[model samples]
Target: MNLFTKYLHSVTLSLSKGIQKIACLLLLSIPLFTQAEDGYKLWLRYDKITDKAQQSYYAPRLKTVYADLSDPSVKVAADELQLAVKSLLGFTPVVKAAGTGSQGLTLTIDPKTEGINEEGFSVSTTPKGIHIKARSGAGVLYGVFNLLKNIQTGADPNVTSSPEIQRRLLNHWDNHNGTIERGYAGMSLWKWYELPERIDPRYIDYARANASIGINGTVLNNVNASARFLTHEYLGKVKALADAFRPYGIRVYLSVNFAAPRILGKLKDADPLNPEVQKWWADKTKEIYDLIPDFGGYLVKANSEGEPGPMDYGRTHADGANMLAAAVKPYNGIIMWRAFVYAPDPKGDRFKAAYEEFKPFDGKFADNVILQVKNGPIDFMPREPVSPLFSAMEKTPVSLEFQVTQEYLGWATHWVYLAPMFEEVLKTDTHVKGSGSTLSGILKGDTFGYKMTAMAGVANTGSDRNWTGHPMTQANWYTLGRLAWDTRLTSESIADEWIRQTLTRNNAAVETIRKSMMKTREIYVNYTSPFGLHHVMGEGHHFGPEPWLDKAARPDWTAVYYHRVDSTGIGFNRTATGSNALAQYPGGLVEVYQDEATCPEPFLLWFHHVRWDRPMKSGLSFWNDFVKHFYEGARQVQDLQAEWQSVKAQVPPEIFNNVEARLQTQYKEAVWWRDACVLYFQTHSKMPVPAPYKAPERTLEEVKKLVDIYHIR
Candidate 1:
C-alpha cells in the first residue's frame, strides 16, 4: 500500500475510537438524570436540596448527631439522620454515641419527660443545637423522622407531637400466595417464597416508609385469612420480617382465620365456648408471642362474609371476641374484632345490618377488645353518613377502619385522593352524647373515656416501583398515616406537606398539583356516584359502570337494591315508611335525615327517593342535575389532564410521564362512567339527555358489553 493510504486508515481508526469514548461517557451519565425521579424512593426521597439557602440553614443545625445507640430503633434513628443530612445538605453529620457532647443534635429517651406520651417526642432548637426528648426509643426514632421532614419541607423544626390513637396500623389484604385481594399496584410486597431463608431488602424499605409516617403496626396477612399462615412454617417467615422491621419501631400483626382451630388444629365445631377451641387459641397466641415478643395482636373478621365465628355455635360476637381477648390480654395484646357482619336478607336494609348486630353488645365487649367498624355503614362507599355504630358504641373502644386501597373508588386506575373523604367522615358529629360528639373524638377515646383507642387503614401499598400504582395515590397512604396519628389535621395541610416532599418544590407546580389532588375525590364521586348513588359499579372487580346490574348472587349485592330506580323515581327510601334505618342514628341526625328538605344534598339519594320531575336546590330538575354531574365530572377530568400538562416542565420526566399516562386513562374512564350511567339510568327515567348536553355516543347495550368485557376475569 502507498504511504498516503496507510495514513488515511490510521486517521479513520483514531476518529472511531474517539466517538466510542464519547458514547460511553454519555451512557454513564444516564443514571445521574434518571435516578432522581424514578419514584422508587417515594416521599422519603432525600435528594439534595436545590436551594442553597435552605441547605446552608440545615447543614449547620445538623452538623453533629448524638443519640443513645443502646436501643436498636435509636441506632436506626441516628443512622437515618446522618444519611438524610448527607443527601439533603451535601455533608454527612458526625454521628456519635450519647454523652459525647451536647453541642449538636441530641436525642434522649426520658420516661420522666412531661407533655409527651410513650411514642411522643418533643424537638426544640437550643443555643448549643437541637435537642430531642421522648419517653421511649420509638419516640426518638419518630422525632428524628419529624425533624428530617421539617428540613425537607422547609419548616421550623420546633414541635411536640404524639399519636392521638394508641395503635396506628395498616391491614394488608395480602394472601399467602403473594396475591393481594383488591390490590391493584402489583402482586404483593411480601415475597412468601423467598421469605424465612432469604429476606428481601424491600422489607426494610417498607418498614422505613411506615416508620417515617408514624405507622407503628402492620397486619401482614389478608383479613380473608388462610389457616396455613398460623402454621410454624409461616411463623418463622413472620419472625424474619419482624426482625427486619423491629429496628424501625414497627411491630407485625397477623389476621387470623377464626376457624383456625377447625382448619389447622383439627378440632370439631371451633366454638368459642368449647374448652378445646379456647386452649388451641391460647397455645397459638403463646407460640406467636414466643417468636415475636413485640407481636402487636390479632385482627379477626369473623361471622362476616361466611367467615366462622361464635355465632356459628349460637353465641354472640362479644362471646367470640372476649375468648380471644382473654388469650392475648396476658401479653398486653388487644383484639380488633371487625363489625362488618351482614346477612343476605332480601327484605332487610344492608345499611342497618352491622348496627343491629353490634349495638346490642356494645358494653359487653371485653376491656382488651376494640370493635373495628368501617367508616361507612355499607362497605366503604364513595360517600355515606358515618356509620351509626360510631355513635352507639359508647362503652366499647371502637377503632375506625378506613379503606386506603380504593376498592370501591375505581381501584388504581382512577386518581382519587381519599384524605378529604376521611376528613369529612371524621369531622361528622355523631352527637351520641351531645352536639359536639364527633367521630374523631370517639376514636380518640376522648368523649367516651374508653381505656384504649386505635385506627387501622386497609393498606394500598404493593410491589409497584412507585409503591402505589398511580404516582399520586402515594398521598393516600401518606394521608392515612398522618390522620391515624392525629385526626385533627386538615386534609389540605397534609396534602401540602406531601406535595412539597414528594414532588417538585416549585411554588407554581405545587399549587397546580394540589388543586388537582384536592378536587380528585369529588370529581370521582361526581362521575361515578353523584347525589349519593353507590354500589353501582361493575360487580366483582368494581370497575366501570353497572347501573343495570339488577341481578346478582344476592338482592342486596345488586345495584337495583341500593338505587331503587323504579318507573316513578330513584334512590332507596330509608325513612319511617321504608327501612327506618334513620332511626338508628342519634335523634338529631334522625330528624334531619328523615326530612328530605333538611337532609344534605350529598346524602339526598342515600336516604330518600324523589321524582325525576322534582326540582333540586340548583333549580334544575332532579334528572337534569344528576345528568349534569356526570358530564361535569368527565369535563373536570379533562381539566385535570390540562393541569397536569401545565406542570410537565416542572416535574421530573419519568414521574411526569408516568402520571400523565394515568391521567389520560382516568379521563377515558370518567367518560366511560358518564356514558354508561347516563344511558342506563335514562332508560328508567324515560328522559332525554337534557338540554345543551349531547347524548352518549354509544347505546346502552354497547356500554353493558364493554363492562362485561371488563369483568371477564
Candidate 2:
C-alpha cells in the first residue's frame, strides 16, 4: 500500500509541474497577440522598436543610466528611463549614482550650458556616452523624456531646449461639480469628492505628461470661478494635488472669484480700496502658501461675462489686479489678469473694447501682475486678426492666451489642427515698433521689453481615456506645449513629430497625416467663417450653423451682428466709413485694413462692406467668390478623408477606425455648414449656387430646424 501511494504522488506532481511550465510559456507570448492599441498613453507609448537598426543602435547606448539619487525629481527621471528602456528596448537599464561610470547615459546639472535656462535641457551624444545636462532636476526629467522621444522618432539624440515663455500653463475650465465649461472630451479629471484622502494614480500620470511637454503649471478650476475654491476645505484638496504634481515639476493654480471676499469671508464689500478686503486677500494668500508652498498664483476673469470685478466698486482692472498681486508678492506668486473683457455698448465694436479698456492703464499694473490677452480681438474664432491690444500696450507685460480646445472649430468632432492657427496669430506683424514686431516677439518680451513673460493654453483635456476626445486632437495639446517651450518651431515640424510619436512611424503615413493636419485649419475657416466672418455659430451652444440668427440678449452675441448682412451687401465695415475699429491697430496695419483693394481677402469682409456685384481679386464677383469658398471648403474635407483612408494599413487598427469615424462625421458637418450658410446668405445676396456646384436640396427653413435641435441650451 505504501509503494502504490508513493508512486501516485510522484505521477501527480510531475503532471502539475508540466502544466505550470506550459502556462508560463503561453503567458510570455501574449504581447505578440495583443495588437489593439487604445490610445490611453498620449504620445508616451514606449513600445519596442520595430526597426531592427534603431533597436540595435539604442539598446546598447541606454544599457545604463547615471544620475544623482539625492533629488526626488532625478530619481523619477532615472526610474522613467529604466521603465522606458525596458518597454522600448526589451531590457532594463541599470541606474546608478553619478560618477559611477561614464560609459552609460549620464545625467548632470550644468549651470553653464549655453541657451539652457532654469528649466531648460541639453542632450548630446558624447564619445564617453550619451550626456544630458540641465540647470534643475525638472530639466533633467524633461531631457530624459526628450531623449526617449528622439529614440522613438529615429532622430539624432542631440537637442537643446529652453521655454520661450516663463510660465507655460494649462488653464482648465473644470468645475467643482465635475463639469467642464467648453470641454467636449468628458467629465473633469479632478475627483473632488475623493481627493486629499484618496488620490487617483491618474494625477501622477497627468503631471508626468505635462512635465514631458514642458508645461510647468495648471489652473485647477474654471475661470468662471466659484468662491468655494478659496475655502479651507478646497484648499486642502488642492494641496493634495499640488503634492502629487510637485515631483513632476507642475505647480497648481486656482481661478479665484473676484467676489470671494464678500462670498467666502462674508465681508460687507469687495472693493480693492477697502483695507478689510486687502487684509482678507493677504490672509488667504498666506493660507494657500502654508498649505502648498510652491503654489502658482491666481488666474482672474473679472468684469467679463457676468463675473464681478472692481468696476462694480468704481475702480479699474489695474486696481483689482494690483491688489491681488500685492497680496501674493511676498510669496513670489503672480496674478494673470485676463484682458478678455467686452462692454455691452451696442454701438461700439466689441473688437475695440479690450484694447480701449486695457491700453489706458498699461503701466499701472504691479510688477507681479501680467495681462493675459487672447490671441484674437474677438473670441477664439476659426480666423481673426491678432488683438490690437498686443501692439498698443508697450509698458505692460502681456501673455498670449490660446484656446487649445476646439470651441468654434466644430468642438471635438472635426479634425482641425490648431498649431497652424496659432502660428498665424503669432507671426502676425503688430507693426507698432516696426515690421518685425510679431506677437511672438511681444510675448517673449523682445518687443515690449517688459519683465515677465508667459503663455497659457485653455486646455482641452478631460476624463476621456485618450485625454482629448478625438485621438488626433491630442496633437493640439502637444503642439501648444511644444510651441510654449520653443516658439521658433514650425507647425509642419510639430505635426511631423506628433504623428511619428503618437500615430505611426511609417514615413508614408507620417507625410500623409502631416499634410492633412497642415490644411485642416484653413478648411475649417473656409467652411465655417470664410472671409473673416466671425462668431456666426448657433446662439448659446455654438454647435451647428446659424447665419440667420438675429435675436439674442446682446447684439454682439448674434451671428447677424457680426456678418452685418443686408440687401445691398455683406460684411462689417470697420473702416473709416463705419465703426473705424481698424484704426485701433498701428498706422501701417490700419492703412492695409482700411482699403478694400489692398486688404487681404481673408480679412476683406472684416473691415469693409462691398457690393455683391463688385469684382474681387480672385476675378470672381464678391458673391461668387464667397460661394466658391464655402463649396471648396466642404470639398476639401472629402479630399482629406481620402488621404486618411490611403494610410489605413499603416496606422494601428484602433486609431485608424477611431479617426475614420470622426472624419466621416467631419465631412457631414462640413457640408452642413456650407449648405446652411450659403442658403441663409442667399436671402441677402440673391445669387445662384453658380456653375458646377449644385444647390442644396434642403431649404434654409429645413436647416433652421437642425439648428434648433442643436441650440437646445
Best-fitting candidate, scored by TM-score: 1
Give the TM-score of each candidate: 0.96, 0.95
- Estimate the Cα RMSD of every predicted model relative to the unseen true structure: 4.2, 4.4
lDDT of 1: 0.89
Give the C-alpha miss distance for residue 56 in model 1, angstroms: 2.8
Tens digits of per-residue lDDT, candidate 1, 371-452, equal 9999999989999888999888888989999999999987887889999999999999877887888899999988889879
Enumerate residue pairs that collide in model 2. Answer: none
Estimate, for each residue in 115-156, the C-alpha lDDT of model 2 and write its tens digit. 888999999886547888999999999999899888988888
Model 1 bad stretches (over 4 Å): 1-36, 100-102, 711-713
Provide the clash count, candidate 1: 0
